[model samples]
Target: MAALAPTAQAGQGDESRLPKAHSWRQWLDREAWRKAIIAIPYLWLLFFFIAPFLIVLAISAGTSQVGIPPVIWKDTFPFGTFDNYVFLTQDDIYWQGYLNSLRNAAISTFFALLIGYPMALGIARASSTWRNVLLLLVILPFWTSFLLRVYAWIGLLGNTSWFNRGLTSILATFFPFWVTGDHIQMMNTNFAVVLGIVYSYLPFMILPLYATLEKLDRTLDEAAMDLGSKPWEVFKDITLPLSLPGIIAGAMLVFIPATGEYVIPSLMGRGDSPMIGRVLADEFFQNRDWPVASAVAVALLAVLVIPIMIYNFFQAREARRGST
Candidate 1:
């Protein structure tokens, strides 16, 4: 009985060491880890995106000076005059730059969507083995240097390049009296900028669309077909509605960056019609007008952020509806 009592007491001691009905400790530990994982992306945006934007906003409000940095030296605070923004309004070039950027970005995004939708649909409908190959093909250009790709286009679109020569031959063969020149003039035009943007950002459009289309319930499609619905009807009613999210996502991804793109515009665009990105570059580097560049950047951000906020709002509402 004495030995049995000691064993019973030892069992009680072990039970005491284990957690009781208050299991919140383990729950807290799990919640902590999950929250930490979720916080990583938010923290990254705060440090990299938001922080830099705030710094630029401060600089935009400051006065420009002749110095090493070329911006005013205000250490204690960041509040400054709105002279830079006023100056921006006084010139037509800044307004023109914004308009050109938006116009080019919109046109490029439209073309990308026009081309990408069919490609994405094909990939989504393809066999598993072929889908991967198609996706890889779509992204093959990214494997090469972006600058090289743009430069290659520059050669192809040049006045005397083979592409232009062959195009000229075709035109002359079809319409011999159209006064065809030696080669077409396609370079140093908005067309070239649009072409480069579409080529570079098409993958962004395709991947999102593929993801959305691939996940659509095939049974819905089959059921519609069973009900004597045609393929076009099924696609319009089922596929298009379901894929709107991906469409919006891809559009934002392509449009936002393309609006501020510097490389393609600077490399392929005419000097007379500079995009906002080129204007910003010239303001900062060539003109050494840091305050004005910062203001332009801040204005661009203001224009882009409104659409993003609207998107997020609609997305959050949809998520809540779905959850319910």
Candidate 2:
């Protein structure tokens, strides 16, 4: 009876040593690695993107003062003043800058799309060897520094540049009266800015369009042709509609950043024509008006975000329809 009792006690002790179902550490050990990997991107966005945006939003709602951190926090609704936003409307410079930014961005995007769509289409249709070569050329500009590329344009467009001299000489032969100078006088103009923007961003417009177009079923076009559809008609019905997603993606990529661009405009645009980014920089640094700068930043975000959100909503709807 005593030996049996000892064996029973040992059995109970072995059962107690086994891991319990409700053990937190055991559950954590099972899920921690899998979850951690999945959470990486979300964690990155929370720390980098969301945190910075929230900080900017907080600063935008604050007041400007003479301090290390110029924006002063206020413990009230409508935070500091609506004055900053009001100033945007009242001041002509801000209005002009905003308008110019939009105009330049729009023009640049149009040119990029016009040029890129064909290039992308060609790449999509080309043989594998030629596709690689064409893609390399499209991406070749990125190998050099962006600042260096812009600087190169400065040399090319300068009044005394060989390019301008040659252009002027060519024009002189045809329109002799109009060619009054040795140079073409293209530097520091809106045209220069647009040219620089298109050159820099063309690849961005091309790559997405290529991806979309490459995946398109060649059979669809052939089928349409068999049904007596003309080439242009088939393109209008099949190609354009199918490639819209890429078009929207490329346009947004170009327009959003181009609208807020400072460097290209600073280097290429006339002194009188300022963009919104330059104005934001001036407000923050030169004027020492953090509140106003923050307000401008916030407003710009709003303008850009609304269109993106609308696009996303429609895309979601389309996706849902497709699934259904």
Candidate 3:
């Protein structure tokens, strides 16, 4: 009985110590590895993404001294004044440029949405093998230089170019006095600028819409049809609602950058149609007013950030609901 008691006590002691068998050193080693893996991406983002933005913010707030040095930081931060913004608001040319930019960007975004939606829908409905080919074709333009593409537009719209001449000649042959050189000057017009923007940013709209639409169930549309809903009704009820996130995302992608687009306007727009982007460039280089240029950039950023945050919030909420 005494020997049996000693054996039972030994068993109890071993059982009591089993949970603590994992040492603090082993636990720490495992945790350290986990933490390192998690921290690497955040560290990279902080250094690359956050740091660059902070620097830009700093520069935008500071004053620029042209001859002595390029930029000189004021003793007071944000300069504690609205001089930059004030200058922009008071100037008639600057205000006109701002309004022109908004109009061009909004119109371009609308046209891009209209053109891209059908193409995206067709691609989503295509067979798997064909879909890849279609997607490849859609993205193919991006591989070519964007600057080269804009330059190509210049040739297409130039006064003595094939397109303009062909149209004028055809109109003259058919309608005689109906169309003339003065009337057909597509080159360096607002129309040309809008067309260029739509052509360039169409891909941004297509890709996102494709992403959302492809994942949608085809039966939803079929069910709508089965219930006697018209094609437009089905789109309004099911398709549009489901695809709202993509639409918003695509619009934002095009609209935000289009607001600040310099190349398209510079290449395609009339000199009289001064956009905010061109104004910013002229301020920086031609006028040599670095402080004003920085102010413009900062203002642009401020205008864009709020809507983007709201969009992200709604998107996240919708995604969560979909998952559940």
The number of residue pairs in model 3 that clash at the backbone is 0
Question: Comparing 1 and 2 by TM-score, which wins?
Answer: 1
Mark the regions of model 2 whose C-alpha exceeds 4 Å error after superposition.
1-34, 75-79, 176-180, 318-324
Q: Please give the lDDT score for candidate 2.
A: 0.90
Candidate 2, residues 212-255, lDDT tens digits: the string is 99999999999988999999999998998999989988998899
Candidate 2, 33: how far from true, in Å? 5.7
**Candidate 2 displacement at residue 139 in angstroms:** 1.1
Between candidates 2 and 3, which one is better according to lDDT? Answer: 2
Cα distance off (Å), candidate 2, residue 36: 3.5
Q: What local distance difference test score does each model get?
A: 0.92, 0.90, 0.85
Question: Which pairs clash (backbone N, Cα, C closer than 3 Å) in model 1?
Answer: none
Please count the clashing residue pairs in each candidate, in the order shown.
0, 0, 0
Rank list by lDDT = 1, 2, 3
> Lowest lDDT 10-mer window, candidate 1?
70-79
Off by over 4 Å in 3: 1-45, 73-80, 169-178, 310-324
| TM-scores for every predicted model | 0.89, 0.86, 0.81
